[model samples]
Target: MKKLLILVLMLAAAFLIYRFAFKKKRAPREKPVPVAVSEQSAGFNQSMNSILSSYYRMTEGFVNWDTAAVGSAATGLETALKQLNVEELKKDTTIYQTALYPLELAKTNTATIAAGRDWTERRHALNDLSDNIRTLLLTIKYDQAPVYWQECPMAFGEGESGDWLSSKAEIINPYLGNKDPKYGKSMLNCGENKMTIDFTKRDSARLK
Candidate 1:
């Protein structure tokens, strides 16, 4: 009888241990959530490319000396912005607002020249705005930022007069006649002057 009792108790304990210990462990798993790209990041690239391409086309028109075409392109760009609206392009749309000032300055300069007025003042103004925009674009991580006058050969020298080019003969080849017209009939009319900005160097280290 005692043997029978002992056997039953041992069986009960074994059954309990097996029930608890032999249960299968759940497999380790990662959360089943979908990874998605932010709309702002994706759309920013698209909008930036579109706007820049349009700006380049307008610049080409200006370089070719087509004032009417430049104005039309600028107008079309502004229209595109209005139609798309900033919210659709980026979460913080104010960055785009910053670009408008220079774009407007460019348009204004082109318009002044087209109106037969002395565009030197407008050009100077546009230059300032362009520089500012370059800085801003760099800050915002825009792909093509303006190259400083130090980097560009024509900005500081090579005006309508040959004095600067003559003086800086050692640094630059004077024999390479000024391909750019300083006192042009109208760069806008011919669409020949396209502004250039440097995109190769970005100082992301300073951004933090």
Candidate 2:
């Protein structure tokens, strides 16, 4: 009777141990969902492509002295503008209002070599637009910029066609004494420009 009681108590303890200690733990947590690249984003991307294509065609026409080609490309610009969801963009951000001015000007103008010269004027408008677009894309991907900036290398050189894409590449490795990197906070071209960002090193890029 004593042996049977001891055996029963041991079994009960084993059952309790199995129920409490051997139970499965929860799976690890998942990362947060990124913003979707939805139909709207796709449409915006298409419009941007159309605009850039038309601009290129218009410039090519001017270079070749083809007035008809320039006119066709100008018409293409109008089509691209029509595809743009101006009202939707305006609702989301004030950036559209700023971009619309130059776009309107470009649309109404006659095709001429002089029209090509208006690029600088148009660019001021478009640069703001581009900045907004980049911000939107980044927001979609990361929800926000990372708390920590990652370091990567980029190449330093002008384009093959001698376009002044970059005046020069100033690489300030924080590990070294050099300060004030030119590409500042951008991640897009770090590797292309052959400059390594040193996150491990002391930061010297801040303005003194």
Candidate 3:
């Protein structure tokens, strides 16, 4: 009985040592590093900023229900779109193809907006134009300005939503606009901010 007790105590001591001391130490888990936004030429950055500015102007026209102003802003957007140094984007084949897809669509939609006179159709075209421009910015990772993506649930018809970009977080919805026959400006602030697009990197091309 004495021998058995001694052996049991020895075994318990060994088990305790193995449990606490023999286990391997684990390495601390590394936190993921955020990928930075890509850099572009000063000209590219300027052109993108100009395009965004023109888009904002167009949004204002929509909000104010000024057809002529909207048309003019659309034209200005086309000019700014042309100023973008597309060749600089061509160096990266993957990015070139992706960026051009939306850029081309922007061209088409802007042209439609500039030429169309139908109010409802023009508003719809602006929705398409807004999407294409947003896609282009995202594809190129444009990080110059603060772009706010907003959506109005009843901009078109009940249950149908429309989206537009703005320079501010405050939702002065371009759709439903400022002129409602029944309730003036009642629905002007009728949208919720979806997200703010700001991928600006720490690099130097940010002179906007």
Question: TM-score for every candidate vs. truth?
Answer: 0.39, 0.36, 0.77
By TM-score rank, best first, the candidates go 3, 1, 2
lDDT tens digits, residues 1-208, model 1?
9999999999999999988999787898764454333223555545645555554455444345555765566565454434333444244567666655554554453344334333344234334434543443453455432332212234334553211101111222111222346644322122122233345453444443
Which 10 residues in a row give candidate 1 its minimum summed lDDT? 161-170
User: Candidate 2 residues 1-208, lDDT tens each?
Assistant: 9999999999999999998999888898875544333324556656655665665565345334455765687678667756766555565455555656655554444223225454333323322332333333333222211112212232223321111011125322211111114443342333223222211222233322
* Best candidate (score: lDDT): 3
Order by lDDT, highest first:
3, 1, 2
Where model 2 places Cα greater than 4 Å from the true spot, the runs are 1-4, 16-22, 36-46, 53-75, 89-97, 108-110, 113-208
lDDT of 3 by residue, 1-208 (tens): 9999999999999999988999777898875555444578877888898999999999899889899899999999999988788879887998898988888889888898899868788889999999998888887888776789999998887898999998899999888888866557899999899988888765344432
Cα lDDT of model 3 overall?
0.86
Rate residue 152 of model 1 by lDDT.
26
